[model samples]
Target chain A: MPERAEWIAVDWGTSALRIWAMRGSEVLAETRGSEGMGQLAPEDYEAVLLRHAERYLAGDRVTEVLVCGMAGARTGWREAPYRAVPCTPAGEGAVKVPVRDERLKVRILPGLSQARPVDVMRGEETQIAGFLAGRPRFDGVICLPGTHTKWVQISAGEVVSFRTFMTGELFALLAGQSVLRLSVASDGHDADAFRDAVGDAISRPESLGAALFSLRAGSLLEGLDPVVARARLSGLLIGLELAGARPWWLGAEVVLIGSAAVAEPYREALAAQGLAAELVSGERMALAGLIAAREVMA
Target chain B: MPERAEWIAVDWGTSALRIWAMRGSEVLAETRGSEGMGQLAPEDYEAVLLRHAERYLAGDRVTEVLVCGMAGARTGWREAPYRAVPCTPAGEGAVKVPVRDERLKVRILPGLSQARPVDVMRGEETQIAGFLAGRPRFDGVICLPGTHTKWVQISAGEVVSFRTFMTGELFALLAGQSVLRLSVASDGHDADAFRDAVGDAISRPESLGAALFSLRAGSLLEGLDPVVARARLSGLLIGLELAGARPWWLGAEVVLIGSAAVAEPYREALAAQGLAAELVSGERMALAGLIAAREVMA
Candidate 1:
């Protein structure tokens, strides 16, 4: 007989749902699907989870499922209310979800919220928790780059405060849907172009609106290369975020938690300004976070 | 017998093609169609123009049609090359499109271009010319608000320089398409919310990315009113523009050229910044500019 799973670790986000069949702290099996919390109704969450997890389940005993990310959102399986900041990331505030399947005991971890700047994180709290678990002594900023990049302040193992920027979404919309779409390449990068744009934006962010339109004009007037334009667009947005996020990163020990593809650009931009931030794998952090939450449930 | 038009004035923009059947500056008739330059190819421009102005044409004599805007774009009827700045708005350069129909003589006015910052404008130049025609010695800044807002510096009856902002387009993309769409109302304006947001953005332009995301967070956490959110979105974008365009408007005579619907927000935002700008009808300026161009052709 196949080994029965001891517990499950799930990271459910807007676009995808990933679950790992865990035997204690070790992942025995893993699977993911496009049926994310964004698309699924609250009633559909149980079946979706069971579909990927059924093979690892033992009919004789119930298995505890530790869920993180958007699955705990108000629209997800059950609303795991946010723990307002100046609180520990992914502490003991996991909400017990009433599941139709008797074999599954699911608890979703609560996200962190900041009232002043009015910021909230659905899934990154767990990732932050996971990162903090490994480095409890670390203090300073945690930059989580994604669709909505979050700059979180961490001190004494608690989320002191946080702010979010729509840099990624803005970049996607401008390069894909705006007039610049005609000028920018869908895939490619120019490091020099990116660095130049980052410098320009950091120095004078007020000119961002004019600078963006110039890309379209530049393409028409100067025959600007598509690759360079794409890099410049990414650099400008990221640079603007860096400018906005100066309070979080300046003279502070910064750690970037994201895939290398996203985090690398931020790191390069920061390096230009004399900051060498430590980079960590987002997936690993999220899994570690789920493991931490599970230990508390036990 | 129907009164033949002395000359036809046309403003062929991206979304609409507007024409005036004029007899010596007096509008004999006016009509506009949805066949904007955006949806038409080079060959299709003549047919679309004729479909609207055919009634104004004389059988024996050719009808002179003065065209402005994107119809002069490279992909439009014919390429009316941009005249680099430090020149009069609607002065001499007008490209005559070779059309199949002998009854039509179309001359498209050249747009203005700035070299340093790399900016361009098409239809707005005609309006600028018209506005300048009335005030020959008008020396200051002209603020033209549209999908792409233009802040132009006018000195000694010439357009010294200008800057363009994608503020309007940004507002549309964010309020209509971004995640904020769920929080912001599709149609409505809160004056107080707009003023506050404008102030916030002007003071802290770098915080723009964060400020935008807060609208979504505010909606989630505080049930931020949709109308207020919409107004706040507009205020933030416009405030950012005002912040960027400060060099153009600060300590300069500011005249706004746009329809009341589009220009009102700008005037209000500027008013909050202690500037009373003169608002003029956009259509009037375009017609006046077309008249001025026709005189030059004669």
Candidate 2:
């Protein structure tokens, strides 16, 4: 039937491994298995991926396997060369990796790179491609907020450039374990403090270098209620992100892609900046990217 | 002999407490105490200070006491009002806190403050006064680097203005407990990486908003050795401090007052900026400030 299912697209991310079998836009079947890259031992990577693949294959013959996300980097099954900037979905490099058998025909997506001063991203390119695939004519700013919040600019279906801010990580650190933990009262947004911090970040972006001291000073000097100090810290961090990403977003439609857990704050931040943003499901994009990669190879 | 020793000056800080008995610059006697502010309980403050003071007072007619450093703040004996900026050691409005007995004449030094977009300093002022006391004719930049680094500019023995940096705290967090802990290979300086980060900080002080991302990106993408990453983080932090204080330090003689434990790296950082810095002992300053206060009261 259909000359033996041509390919299977796998979106293996930090959290889970998901597979979709499809011919064209129509899906044949979708399955998932527990083989997240984060938990696997470096040596057990192939076994984990293949074992997960077996559950999805269901004894059906599949000719090719396409992998996206952290599965192809140094810690992944194999190292793939990063494609330099000015990259597109169609123009990106693919690494054909040999698993247990040559007949398996596995290809991992390559990441995008920035040369001068050197930076690179592996899993994000696929997400960008998926975004472009769904909205081909979209030309604006796209924000993927996660442990590392990436602000990418897309124009005419190509990633022009991007900058990443450590918003999510800093949030985790400050809220979960850092010195600010003693002060952070709740996870919920403190709207008033957030707005104040955002204004502060934008108005005195340079002061951010000094503004951080406020976290401790607030408590030490003004008797900044510990809870309010927490909120202010959050605001200061997010405000900094807004300030840094402001130049990239000049007069551009803002699009946010990530789990609600990650996207909501970013949306709020963008809204605070007086920018309207369209939310897209990050999981769906991961799937869409896998599908797009399959079609490219086909 | 001066109607018996009237009071004892207790300098209780992070590490140790040194008690001084004086009827002005003429030191009657001094004694070392095992008690430190960090080790004492909130309720035990009076007992603790008295316990140490008792060793030095030794049945002498003690009437009043003057305390500085951690003892004057909340964590210390009592919460004192932070004296706002443009303040001098001799200026009025500095908090004169009363302890246990009114005639005890206990006057804890008032911490400095910055109004409008508030910032404050506690123990650093004493160090500033100590620095000025030692070299009253000296007028320029005086830096007291430690868990909180204070870069202060002085004119005619007055603290014109100053800024506080969390350099020591950041170092402790990053090297001792943060995610970068895994990357910290050497406790000593990595001169090459430190210089690179210093230059990076100076050249793009604004990028500090984004520069932190390099810690993760360096490890993830370019295979940045963790140890180097740790050093780089330290460098970036110190570099940012240098940049933030640059405006205050313009055309000023920089005097670093803190123990070798805290001042060495700051000295290196200053020298990197082509600024000549003279090292002053924080211990000596504390003693000097206590002596100066005793003299003024006399």
Candidate 3:
């Protein structure tokens, strides 16, 4: 007989789903899918989880699932009303869903919101919580680079204030749908081009509008390479984000929690500005976060 | 039979083709089509124009066709290399394409390019040329808002300097393709929301990233109306454009040339900033510019 399941850690977002079979602090098995909240109806969440976890499930064993991200959104499985910020980022305020199956006990964690600046985050809070669990005394800015990149402030084990930037979404749209698509390559990087664009964007941030259109003009006038074009586009967008994030990152000890692909550019950009930033593997943080949330479930 | 064409004025853009059947300075008839440069091969341009102008091409006599916009692009009918800046926006150095149809004489006019800021505009140059012809001695800024908005400066019949902003494209992408698309509406505008957003964006342009995400957050947390969401998005983008364009529009005699629908927001934005500007019909300006360019042809 297989070892009985203890609990599951799930990160259910709009477009992707990730789950780890966990026993205490150790992850036993992991699985991910495209069956995220956007692709499933409210009633289908239980079945979908079971289908992906077939290999890990044991006969007649009840499994506790700790969930985060859009699974708790109004459009997701069930609405977990946001816990307004100045609160700890953790398993607290979780919403319990009455599942049809007796074998599943699911608790979806609540996201954090700021009332004054009017900001909110779904998945990154759990990652922040996990980072905090690992480094209890650490207090500074945590940069989470994703579709909506976030800069979070932490003090006394609570999320103080945070801001979100649409840098990644802008890059994706421009690279795929905008005129720059002709000049942008799918996979390449030019360090020199990126560094120069970052410098220009920070000093003359308002030039972003004119500079965006220049990708086409430069391609037409100077035959600019696609790799350079892609790099410049990425650089300009990130540089603009940094310009907005200076207050949160300049004097603070910054740590970037994201995939190597996304976090590397931010680390380089922060370094160019004379700041040393540490990057932590986002998968580890996410699994740790979900595990931490599960330990507190009823 | 329909009246034979005296001259044809064409605005062959990326996705649309527009032509005016004219005699002297008066338009006898006007027709436009979606068969723009994007939909045609180099050899296919002559046939497409002939098909669309069949009603007016009654005689064996060659009808002069004055063309502008991407029809002069390298990928269009024939290449008309851009005219470097600090020159008059007109029939200077137009490229003549040898046509298969004996009844047509086609000349594609050149677009304007700036070397320093690295900007370019194709069809807007024709409108600016027409605006300048109507007010020959008038000297100031002419704002042409569209997919790619242009701000042109004229002094003594010469386009002294100019800049282009990708405001419209950004709006389309953000509202149609990004995460904010869930909250943005197509057919509504909140005047108060727009005015206030414009004020905030102008004062703190760097806050654009956070402000954009706030559209979704506000929708989730505060039940934001889609119309208000759209207006805020538009206001923030245009405000950013204006912030970059402060050097061109401030203290200048500004004229807006475009379709009423597209130019209305710009006019309101300028008014919100306490600027009195004149509005001109883009079609009329384009026809005038083409007529003026035809007069220069040998």
Candidate 4:
């Protein structure tokens, strides 16, 4: 005998996919795959989703599927239109997709968009919803860090305005692909070096570009440690982001929603800047957000 | 009758090899190939030089070869150690590479390096030499923009100090490899958008990361033109470089060495800040630099 899955929840992005077998507001089982939206054709998405969720399926009964992120993008499985800003992050406006398997009924949730300053986010909105569900009266900024780190303002339980930065992506390119690659290692960092770099960039944000090349120069001339080099690179980019995002988090209570590894730096950097940031697990928030959406759409 | 080769000038970079056939100080014929340092082995560099200059080979007599750039890097043909900063850019101490063909007598010129801020430049030293030889008394800043844009301070005839920026490389990655690629065109620009972006970054350098993402959001929300997005991207990076390099060129005579395409935006941006810039052709500078090096080495 196997546990029956009442519904399915998915968070899909450019590189990977994660799914949860939900029984009402509770998750019964969890799984994910590398068959992300980027590698899938419109017709290929259904098969990947179904294959990954097969083990959780108990019978021929229909499994309500709720998805957020790139699956709703225009180039993804099916186009789920965006819900404009100043609105709740939910599955209310989710668009249904016809599936070959009668056991699968899917709805892709819409992302959020701002018109004036021009900003958008997909899967992170689901985490925002989950964070809001646990604290409905929460009114502050939600800093969601990833490849494209997003800083969103919430007032009276609705998203007011938001901005995104390419900090993580920039670090990846500089460390792994740029000329700085030879000077930096994949892991290990010096805390003192990270702190010094943070202070340097934050104090003089103008020197960011020159400081980047200095990593290579430092390695060549002064025998700078590779660990310190990696740490300094991370510190510089994050410090630059902190300098830019000061307006959003200056005197405000912030909730950081992301993995421990990614969120830790923001927390440390904020602390270094004299701010307290509350932490939330990105995975759990995604799950909670999906379960909440299922209650409205299923 | 075939032309005789009295000398050879070669620029071996990471991606391309260019050589000029010279009779005394005048170039007789010039040829280049895609056999860059990144694509060839240590032993493969000699064959490339010989084959490209085969037409200029005369009576098996020793053909004096003067080379610049990455061919002398540790990973290149044979490492020609770098000369410390606050020194004249000369070929007097260039390392001679032993070759199989007696017809090819090669000496790879040493690059310049600084200890404190940690900076180095290989091929650009030759350009600096060329510029100085033509205008021996000119004293100011020499800015060479490319994948790694270099800003050098020349007091008298020596490269006193310098800094390098990853601006051009960042533009290439963001415009071609990052998510911003979807919203940017290859070879088009909006000058007005470019100027506005430059002013924005120059005045508020901290907002660079956020402003980068705005390009994508603008496309998604306001139908921002791809050409405008491309221009804005270039302007932002260059403006950021200028902000960091203010000490080098502000209120001082500046010389820009590069192609029209690469130097155009820098020129415009400098003009925006009330700084007039004199442009120099990079190819001619390289040839002149080689000629200067040959006069010493030959």
Question: Each prediction's DockQ?
Answer: 0.78, 0.31, 0.75, 0.83
Candidate achieving the largest lDDT = 1
Residue-wise C-alpha lDDT for candidate 2, range B1-298, written one tens digit per residue: 3224556666766556787776656567777777777677767766666665554443534366777777766766676677777767632333455456333556677678886546667777877777677788887888888777777778888877777776677667656654456456546567788878877976665565467766666666677777677668778878877876788666778888989967877778778888878888987788777767656655
Worst window of 10 by summed lDDT in candidate 3 chain B: B289-298
lDDT of 1 at B116: 85
What are the runs in model 2 whose C-alpha is more than 4 Å off?
A1-40, A43-67, A76-81, A89-108, A175-178, A223-231, A264-275, B1-67, B76-81, B84-110, B153-160, B171-185, B188-196, B215-232, B264-274, B294-298
Candidate 4, position A154, lDDT: 94
Give, for candidate 1 chain A, the lowest lDDT window spanning 10 residues. A289-298
Would you list the clashing residue pairs of candidate 1?
none
Off by over 4 Å in 3: A1-3
Best by DockQ: 4
Q: What lDDT would each prediction earn against the true structure?
A: 0.90, 0.71, 0.87, 0.89
Instruction: Report backbone clashes per prediction.
Output: 0, 2, 0, 1
lDDT of 1 by residue, A1-298 (tens): 5568999889999889888988888988888889988799999999998888888899999998888999888888899999999888885788999998999998889887888978888899999989998998888999999999999999999889999999988998898888889999999899999999999988888888998999988888888999999999999889888888998999999999999998999999999999999999999999999888777566
lDDT of 4 by residue, A23-122 (tens): 8887788888999888889999988987889777756678778898899998899988788988888757999998898788888999998886788988
- Give the Å error, residue B224, model 2: 5.2
**Number of the candidate with higher DockQ, 1 or 3:** 1
Off by over 4 Å in 4: A58-60, A296-298
Question: Chain B alone: TM-score in each candidate?
Answer: 0.98, 0.83, 0.97, 0.98
